[model samples]
Target chain A: MNFPSKLIEDAVTEISRLPGIGKKTALRLALHLLKQNGAVTEALALALTRMREEINYCKTCHNISDHEECSICQSHRRDRSLVCVVEDIRDVLAIENTNQYQGLYHVLGGVISPIQGIGPEELKIESLLSRITEGEIREVILALSATMEGDTTSFYLSKRLKDSKVKVSTIARGIPVGGELEFTDEVTLGRSILTRINYSQD
Target chain B: MNFPSKLIEDAVTEISRLPGIGKKTALRLALHLLKQNGAVTEALALALTRMREEINYCKTCHNISDHEECSICQSHRRDRSLVCVVEDIRDVLAIENTNQYQGLYHVLGGVISPIQGIGPEELKIESLLSRITEGEIREVILALSATMEGDTTSFYLSKRLKDSKVKVSTIARGIPVGGELEFTDEVTLGRSILTRINYSQD
Candidate 1:
């Protein structure tokens, strides 16, 4: 770990602070930057700095955006009455890539994980409730992950919205597409069988 | 990946340009940055920019440094008559980590590789000879990698240095420390057998 220069040591230290990147990988990356054009390093630095300083969060849905409100929340083509709730902005992109849902989305930022010291108060639950109370939403889909924290957040949200007029539902849990029944996990297989839908010709 | 913000997209693109990182990993890193304090990203950007703009190459050995000469070349404790020739700064670092050598180093930048369009003129071979011709150096050790290009470069250098008074040698090639003989490669095993040294009490 003997660095030839303090500048390189500083760069390596900062880069290795990122998750999954170790010191050796950071040194390799720093050397690569040194080998490339100065403009490349300058551009990367400018991009990261600008991204950190200028990005905004949608005031309503809590997703990242270039403006005060995200494009999805501002779009007129989306069904405002049907809202799909997800854990973070990445989930919003994943669901959008599927092209299956046309409704607007509400990002919860993160689920309630007591082990991580994250509770419902730290999430965007209050804003989501406010959006639902605004009276245009008729259905709310809990699209969180299948982990314990996801289920806890979903249950909490369902209880909070029990008095509201909006019907609360959750995305179906089952073996993934292209998954074999023999290799599927027990809980998933049992749930898929219990919630099996009647077959029909498309 | 349908990033919600243009800033995030730009950051992801630049971060993904680094070796071993992909769009998904870039996005994950970008999100992790967004989740943390803004100062973290700013520090990384600043460090990279400073390193790229201010880092220098040693005028003598071509190793990276903050000054005109590297610490190794400036050290009076090292044997000026003995020199270890390596391909890059990383190789110099690797040898330094061993703590066995007490000589100076000369970095040739890279080995001769036709596939990479690198010739003798592209490296610091001429400088190395000039240093040797100055009459202070008595021995030169070639510590390049055990690869085809490394051998080609070594051969070319030996031909050029045959008329010089300095003794030429190469780092020994054998099975790696703690390596299992059952899984060792054939070429290394054969070479180790041919070049076996007599056992001695150290």
Candidate 2:
């Protein structure tokens, strides 16, 4: 669409660069910003610029952080011996929100996807191995996705730590908690049966 | 959602302030920006800031412009005798894109909507009248939406210009060019039949 102003055109071009936003949506967003108070645009611009320029990754876990180490890594209450391995910081946020686990996280950044030209070396696997070598983390839980890339990454990490003394485990694979038996996929249903736990364990 | 960093939280909050975007989508966009090269965020911020700070409305027609006057109003080739009045700059762009009209445009900023607390005085009606009174524009075309508010604004403008020497007209209300008659609504189909033109006139 033709914009009446060059400034609007430029703004739309920049906004459409984002994922899921197209030129029309970008134009609508630009016009919306124009309709709102100037402070709205100012605050958005300032916040985004600050985030891009000043945000840091945790040196220990590779999670997004404002400082050298993330809050989770700095907290003394978390179980230092347990580390949950995941794909990125979003996964870290998801697991953290659940409040089921109280351990540090090791964000591998991404998985091994040959189609995308990504391999083990492209991720933060070295840092994760170094953390395990430090001898503080006793168990590493693989909390990655259930996709093929996730399986490949898990296999590679397990093979690399075969000689290490750290115990490597993976999150349980089964039907979702509220899922009905009839609607559940066969593979997950089979896994749920195979990994059935003692009813009185809780 | 819980953000790993305060910077990310701030960015997501600002992004979600815009129309349509929610907290989850905002978080996704913030993460996507972080994953991309820094230049993407930098350019977006700069463009939006510049647009918000420096963009102007055409002094005469009230259309969004980078300068005092818009290109449509500045062009000498456009018909000075005919003026198309619209609700906003987007309408001006839409009509211009058709490439069928050679007349200039007068953006009313918005239609008169009592529910939204918008009135004739709040729009550029006075400026449009002033332009018409200058004796150059012989015809005024109301190209506003076909909504109730649009009709109200058109009636208001036509009433105000009843005594003026310039002729007042509105866009034809009929079914769209490629629309199927069987699927067309009753009111639109009725209007189309009533306003049917001579085939040889084209």
Candidate 3:
């Protein structure tokens, strides 16, 4: 069947691009947006506009931020000597929600997946090395997922930092198979974090 | 503890207002939009802006349109004699996907909901009656859900249209209990359309 109009079709196409959103969901979301008052729609548009105009990755921690340095990296209360390395900004948020970790973060952008054309160069591993070289980092927590790529990245990082005095560690992988840090319940993630172990022994 | 920033928090709050979107999901989507290049985010913003700036309810059928009348109403191939009444614009898209029906549509916006304060006056029932007064219309298909509100609206409409010579019908109740028409597979929705029943004795 034909679309009601090109604009409607375009909206469907745009909304479908969102993660986990399929064609039918996109159509519903588009129609829902269509029904809203101009102010609400404009608010979404303004948010999107602001995201484009203002957001940038913090040079220090690599978290999404509106400034040159993310709030997490700029905060004085955070322990700079304890850096948590994660795969993406989502992991940063997950860690922040725990409220128990007082350490700073270093986002790797993604795990090393050679099959998917993602290698060490594609990630921010170089930046991480420089940050640790500053000599203040006494501990580096690998908070990457429990996937194969996550394990490989942890092993690679542990090997690379072997000569350094920095104590490289990893969060426990007891969250069950196929579990994602993003979807894991907060309590479970918290427990896993509390039960962290040294990665060098593995 | 506090949101990354006030602007980020505000944007996430707004996104969370959407159906099925939680705080974490909202934050993820907001961050995703922020991470994209300016042009991609601008396109997303433009989609929202244009949807707000251009879309309005079709004066005749109450369906969302970029103009005074929707494309279906403007099309010459569609049967003006047959008007398919639906709960919302999403229903219109569902029917369109099947490529079966070639008639105009009337969006009621919602069904009769006593608790939600929705009634005949709240919807575009009077507008549907106004369209039928032209005498060219021969049939009216009630394509609403099988909820209590849907049943009430259908029964109310059948009674109201009994005096008119126009034929009244309802889409078959092939949809499962508590199931939304939006989630019903296209095949099931198509079968329901093929098995529609006459609501009036005539």
The local lDDT score (0 to 100) that residue B133 gets in candidate 2 is: 80
Which pairs of residues collide in model 1? Answer: none
DockQ of structure 2: 0.74
Highest TM-score, which number? 1
lDDT of 1 by residue, A21-126 (tens): 9998999999899888999999999999999999899998989999999999999999999999999988999999999999999989899999999999999998
lDDT (Cα, tens digit) per residue for candidate 1, span B18-106: 99999989999999998899999999999999999999999888899999999999999999999999998788888999999999999
Q: Give the higher-DockQ candidate: 2 or 3.
A: 2
State which candidate has the highest DockQ: 1
Model 1: which docking level applies? high
User: Tens digit of lDDT per residue, candidate 3, span B32-122?
Assistant: 7765666776787787677667767788888877788887898999998999999987789889887889988999998999898887898
Candidate 1 local distance difference test against the native: 0.94
CA displacement after TM-score superposition, residue B189 of candidate 3 (Å): 18
Best by lDDT: 1
Chain A TM per candidate, in order of listing: 0.95, 0.93, 0.82
Provide DockQ values for all models, in the order shown. 0.85, 0.74, 0.46
Cα TM-score per model: 0.93, 0.88, 0.82
Per-residue lDDT of A13-103 in model 3, one digit per residue for the tens? 7877778888788777777777677788788778767756765678888877768888888889988899999988778777888788999
After superposing candidate 3 on the true structure, give the runs of residues whose Cα lies further than 4 Å from its correct spot. A66-68, A175-202, B174-202
